[model samples]
Target: MGYNNLCEIGEERIRRAGEKIKSEIEAENAQLTLDSTPKKVPDIGFRVLRVDDSNYEDRRKNVGSYSQADLDFDVDITKSDRSNLDLLFEALPKFQLPYDVRINTLSGDEFDGHTVYSVDDGRLLACFEADIPESLVRAMAAFSPRPSYALVSEHSLPDSAARTNFVEIFKQSADSKTGSTKPYII
Candidate 1:
């Protein structure tokens, strides 16, 4: 499909460009023979993010009219169409984590429906799942090479008691090790 998606066209263009360069180099190498030096093909890659409506309801629009009804209406801060990738990228800068840093989906154990992201293999970790489990919080708090920080969506884990317990786990994890493992709610 023509222009169906950016990734398709982008990769195809890179492949074609590489082929063209290699062919030209081969022709030039024929002239140089023993003097010819190898040409390295540079790596090609991309980072994809979609431009979408704000994840949170437009607070400016709701201002002055803010009320219990508005609060209840705006409970689901994130937009319906915003995917997990979208939320993760949006939260990256919020946590002061670099966007270009490597990140992978955390595996090994399920965390009560939460999706965990381990950045640079635990330089930082984030969980955006709602109603985050205590076990999950503890795991994050104790994760090796302890992240410079961690983040949970304020909307995701709204329970006060659970939040308190999460802070306590951070305290223990911090005590067991030196340095700060910042934990924040976005």
Candidate 2:
């Protein structure tokens, strides 16, 4: 087959796989539902932003303090498929993306705490929570220039032997043009 034909086939396979996983997740969970489907398929992708203490210092001294940003993404799944989504999330570590990553759902919250390890290729993974606030979701979707994915991280030094690093990576996106200079404190 031609390259385009092969590519189309591959995409079809991926779509079928996603559909199958969605079905399985629905079968396992009873509360999940497809609240809204995107009118058009998004350009699904990922981005990574790195913030080391040295970089922060350089930016602060020259470019001002780095701004705090939030990342957002959407998954087409019903409440019933939450379990399957969790399973898929757990399976991401095995893909060998140059990082050992874990996303654990914190108690009393709807989503999980994303923990990244051994990051060599600047990739992190996590699952989405159903109860994300609409305003926050809208804000996250409104990043200027709208990246398919976004990564925000910061570095700090506070009289410690080692510098502190706070990083967040996102897998969904939209177009918002507001900018701020708030620092992420994690």
lDDT, model 2: 0.31
- Cα deviation of 141, candidate 1, in Å: 0.4
- List TM-scores for all candidates, in order: 0.69, 0.20
Candidate 1 error regions (>4 Å): 4-11, 15-45, 60-73, 110-114
lDDT of 1 by residue, 1-186 (tens): 677777879878877787887778767766765865866544444465556666666655636778878776665677767766677788777667777878889856655445788887787788877777788888888777778888777666666677777777787778544676878776
lDDT of 2 by residue, 44-128 (tens): 3322323222211111123353333211111121233334233333334344432223332222222122321212222322223
**Reference-based lDDT, each prediction:** 0.73, 0.31
Which one wins on lDDT? 1
How many clashes does each candidate structure show, in the order listed? 0, 11
**lDDT score, candidate 2, position 142:** 40
Model 1 Cα displacement at 111 (Å)?
4.6
Position 90, candidate 2: lDDT: 37
